[model samples]
Target: MPKLNLSQSPAVRAKWEENLKLDSQEKVTSSQQQLPNSAALTPQCIEKRWQVIAERTNKAALLDTDSEKQQNLYSSNIEHFIGTVKLPVGLAGPLLVNGAHAKGEYLVPLATTEAALVASYSRGAKLITEAGGVTALVINEGVTRTPVFEFANVTKAGEFVAWAVTEYEQFKQLAHSTTRYGKLKDININVEGNRVYLVFEYLTGDASGQNMVTFATNTIYQYIIQSCPVDIHSCYLDGNLSGDKKPNSHTMRSVRGKKVVADITIPAALIEKRLHTQVAKMVEFGQMTTTGSLLSGGIGVNAHYANALAALYIACGQDPACVAESSIGITRMEQNAQGDLYASVTLPNLMVGTVGGGTHLPSQKACLDILGLYGSGNARALAEVTAGLCLAGELSIVGAFCAGHFSRAHQRLARR
Candidate 1:
């Protein structure tokens, strides 16, 4: 292919000249028409730009600001902020959680636009609450960050892996040195030819430690570069081995954020009265769905965990994107001898925290406060509630499907 001279093209000449002037630090003549002023598109600048455009377009209320309450919120959290995009946040519960830490009737704030979502969850919450609430257990807690290193050959990569295992204490010390709240818990080694992925798992206290583990891993990476026994050809921060914000089989088996199991046993009579479905039907539905999920080679077998996770995460100031992985889990429904329904959800990766990220935002914090999950020390409680809420949602949605009321309910509520 021949290279075309962009300088000869009038369309490209102006941009090329501007780039050359920028590179050479040459001042353009004042007679030259300057580019529109866009120095750091702050909220003020964005508002001004919108106003100018509105004047030309006869558009009213297009650039209005309802963020008089947000003047103090835009420091480092965001840039180019005009106003907050409002989602219709609805209160769903009085969800009674019988967990190790979270034991109470707490109102769940759910931010969603989907009609009947909150109503469905609320119906489930009522069933659980009346049935003495859902029991939630936090089985494990650890956040992981993986960094990949390349060696000359497989032999060197294997050697590096062995060295990493031996120098675990040193790596832990280096990782822990970066943050006061984060502690290095475990290191997993994965080898592929001349490449090695060092999966660093950490206990990030009170905060969902994506950023925490990243910074800690950077320190460990520096240490590995300085002290590795083998010569490394290249090193990259994440090799997608940590499975951050993506579905992975390992995250489903092992702990990612807070491995939580929530369960509730509803009597046959109550299932008939509340869910309008028999225990046997719900159990059969579970079996069919689970088999279908297994046949599809899915990571977890569940009905719409993302619906609950996303709504709750957004309402409660969590890393909403983490729902991608956090929603991966199993929902089991079994029929007992007495015809009672034993339903449980195992959320192996419920990535949540009470601090950091958008948890401090005004609306998000208010929502967290509604669950009593604001600030520090309530991360475990938050995890438990999150898991319990998920179970409630699954039960409701699955029951809706089983009872053949899913479409009817949507048609009735969603249309309005």
Candidate 2:
């Protein structure tokens, strides 16, 4: 819950206008330092904010059109995402990013472009292995519950859903001590198979909804099986998958985690030969500036913030820390018909969440909310958008290495 002294909306609006007037004269400072981790705006509010930002920018080209924002986002077709399930929440932080993860170790270059998060993790992995390398094994997993709720049967599933559908104040009262539930979430249920599923969309507030979703769903599931009036028969919690680990709706269980895919292309020549060096060089560039080194700074503008926006997704949400999958970039060199070298780059994973974890930090949430890309639906979409932004950035860099004039568009917008 954010507190706003909107005792004076008009005054606040005036200051915003004044700030724009002042910013117009200066080089628009790089937003890396200014923007927060997230925001709380709904899609509609996000649009309005961008309209205001457009006015401030005084440029049609730079205006953040909603479609452009949406264009950067990706997701499975609506049908695949039409259903969902819940799983027990888990916590894995207190991540001592700036130093030793727990007290006595090495100093870290966190909060910098050159941070070495993966490198540090690798060192930690090395210490655990005797033969200089460690092997990872498959661990068991389960889905917490798979019950869908409509306007009715709220109580049967668990208290969280039961209360949210009621009046707002009643919900507020019930949520008073809610460790995590519906403040930053919503429920949309669609039935499939013999199961009634609950699409548990929660805004874990901050700290990634991991703990919040697990407990809330687990508590609710237990209540449903024990108290609900319907014939549950043998309810299964895997939502869409199954076996001995199946869980009944409204009870605690777990899922094998969401599937995240990333793709990249470097010309065959690049992949088969010399350009591997280029790719390695770029990877070196990423590592040199990632979140675990002192060189986190001086990595140039926007790069650190861009990586932060992406890395935060894996760290807080469900990526299982695929720093390597995301540790990708592409480079291309080709001959145009007229004979000039044409080159390009693409990065496809780069996950980012607009609403979960520290996204709600005063400024962060404001950033997410302003974009209207918060919460679950948006979380999935944001991962795609962040990837697109990075891909675009990568392309922009490659273009500069070849075609030239990367900032021309920005300058054109500034003139507008």
Candidate 3:
């Protein structure tokens, strides 16, 4: 292939120079535009920022500032405050959950822009509710922070690991000193040649403990650096072993946050009536999809766990980014001896909380309030509910696929 020189042509060269000049002018104009630098949560600062945005974009008509109130309440959650972006929140359920912590029928609030999503989840919820609700269980709960310590050789790494094992009590005490809700559960040492990765697991009660564990681990890291007899060549707060905020095979096998499982037995008649499909067909669809998922080298096998999880996370004020890991789960559908549809979803990384993060924000709090899971003593319940929600999503999507209504439903609901 030969490279063409557009500069040789007068028309092309003139057009290129004009385009460059326009790009330069636009960059200069953009550089000159400035918003308020103050991080104050005051309405005055917010208004000034909005004014700058309006002047610069001339397209701020859609961004409403009229809804701005209680700006200080958002101080902890946001910086360089501006008005909120409103998403259409829909209600799904009468999702009856029969879990250890989360029990009874609850209305699930789903904040999303996707059409038919709430309806699909609600359809599954209704089926589950009629079938005596879903049985959800908090199998385990733990958040992790993996701090890597590098040494000169494998001998030094092994020695550091040996010494670190004795200091578990001290590390636990140091971690506890930082947060009332977070508890250091266990520490597993992973050695890779000359590096030692300290995987610190914690039970974070009622709040998603990313920042909590990070702070506690940093404290322990500093203490180790100062007091450890072993010489460390290098150190990092996170060694990516914990799989925070990313979908990986590690989180699929082990828990990164709360591990929750939800299952429901839908009668053959109920499956036919509600889902417009037979139990055998649903099972067959599940088998094919599971095989396809495995063939694709995916972390977890599921139809669309992210759909329900993203909506729930947004509505509940949980970190939306955690949905990456939280959505990785296994959805199984099999016909029981009684010919009923036995469906289960095991979510190993359902990173959620009923306190902290965006949970206290007005709309988020309101959503959590709707589920009656707005504060402490409700994190486990929240996780259970999340699993149930995902189960509902799985059933609905699978039913749609089996019934040959997936694209038709989307066309009717979304393509309009």
Question: Which prediction has the highest TM-score against the true structure?
Answer: 3
Root-mean-square deviation of each candidate, in angstroms? Answer: 5.3, 21.3, 4.4
Local distance difference test, per candidate? Answer: 0.86, 0.35, 0.89
Residue 289 miss distance in model 2 (angstroms): 28
Residue 25 displacement (Å), model 2: 80
TM-score of each: 0.88, 0.28, 0.91
Candidate 3 least-lDDT 10 residues: 58-67
Which candidate do you rate higher for TM-score, 2 or 3?
3
* Cα lDDT of model 2 by residue, 110-167, tens digit: 1222223333222322222211111111121121223443323434444434443453
- Candidate 3: residue pairs that collide: none
* Model 1, residue 39: C-alpha shift (Å): 8.2
After superposition, the stretches of candidate 1 with alpha carbons farther than 4 Å from their true spots are 1-44, 47-69
Query: What would the per-residue lDDT of candidate 1 be over residues 1-416, giving only the tens digit for each residue?
Result: 23347648786776676777675554445423232376443556666655545545533333334464454564556554444567899887779999998999988999999999999998888889999999999999999988999999998888888888998998888887899999999888889999999888999999998999999999888888898878999999899888899988897778899999999888999999998988899988989988899899898888988998999898877888999899899999998787799999999998899999889988899999888889889999999998888888988998899999999999999997
Question: Distance (Å) between predicted and true CA of 273, model 3?
Answer: 1.0
Q: Which has the better lDDT: candidate 1, or candidate 3?
A: 3
| Residue-level lDDT tens digits of model 3 in 195-237 | 9999999999888999999999999999999988889999989
